[model samples]
Target: MNKPEDAPRAFQQAWNGHDMQALGDLFHADATFVNRFGRQVRGVSAIIEMHAPIHSTIYSDSTLENELISVTPIGDDAAVLHSWSRLACGPAHPAGPHVIDTLFQAVLTRRDGAWKIIALANVTLADPRTGRAMLRV
Candidate 1:
């Protein structure tokens, strides 16, 4: 069982490795994911289906700059993690991926001694200059 602090590293590693299954493994079976667009995707399976293609395309060369904001303990077997991340493209980006500043919250529960994300919500910060979406979403 990994500590709650392990989630961010796991997430970053999965994204950087471009491994969909590994990424999905971080979530619980009944997990719900809310994207920056406000669409709610329920279940880990649904999240994988939706993200696989996007990750292969616009975000293929993206890397996350993640900062752990806080971890609040809900009980002995549950916790909520708050994090902020900036998704940016590397030199190999196909068409210059949009840079996005995102804030996310994840609710994790200990299942069989392992922590799994049960819910996640991502909010993209608007561009202060343009007052519009910071990323292509």
Candidate 2:
């Protein structure tokens, strides 16, 4: 990544393309990630392993769009960022097409002059009153 803000869009683009290799390239070797479902994985290998199958299965026909929320510089080479994203499933999905809104927070660090995610977390937005996933704000 060239800038800290670029990481969120890059991540959504990778997921949309369903390319594990591309997605993995955005992270550091020891990166940590937490999915919307509360699944956590550490290390690039484990992160790829956890995500690859879903990209081929449930999320095979899913498309994602991310809107950057904020990017705060921690130093010259480190930053914390937030993004809002929506995932829309295609008709082929088993439960029928649906949309989910999520919020993501990521910590990125530049190593050897290349920016990469060191830690990330994703959470599904929900309605407190209905106890259901919120598709809109």
Candidate 3:
């Protein structure tokens, strides 16, 4: 990726396309990830393993859209990026078709002139008034 924030958009596209190979290419070999469900995983292959099944099941007809919120550079090679994502799940989802808003924070580093995610955390956005997970239209 040309910039640190580019990772989110790449992720959105890869997920929307249901391309696991493309998704795996965006992370470092020893990368870490925490999903919105609070499941934590490490390593690129592990991340792919955890995500692959979902794409064919609950997320088979899902689409993801991400908007970069901020990019904070820690150095010439390291940066932190925050993005908001809207995940529209398909009817295959256990809860049925729905739209959810999520927040993702990623720590990326430039390696070999390409930016890759080293760590990422994802959370479901909550409704402040209800203190519950928010579902959007």
lDDT (CA) for every model shown? 0.85, 0.93, 0.93
Q: Write the per-residue lDDT of candidate 1 for residues 69-128, one digit (tens) a residue.
A: 899999999999988878887655665656778888999999898999999999988877
Candidate number of the best TM-score: 2
Q: TM-score of model 3 relative to the true fold?
A: 0.94
Candidate scoring better on TM-score of 1 and 2: 2
Clashing pairs in 1: none
lDDT of 2: 0.93
Clashes of 2: 0
Give candidate 3 misplaced runs (Cα > 4 Å): 128-131, 135-137
**Tens-digit lDDT track of model 3 for 1-137:** 89997888899999999999899999999999999999999999999999999999999999999999999999999999999999998899999988899999999999989899999999998988987988545
Among all windows of ten consecutive residues in candidate 3, which has the lowest summed lDDT? 128-137
Segments of candidate 1 deviating more than 4 angstroms: 90-97, 127-130, 133-137
- List, residue by residue over 28-100, the lDDT tens digit for candidate 2: 9999999999989999999999989888888899999999999999999999999999999987678889998
TM-score order, best first, reads 2, 3, 1
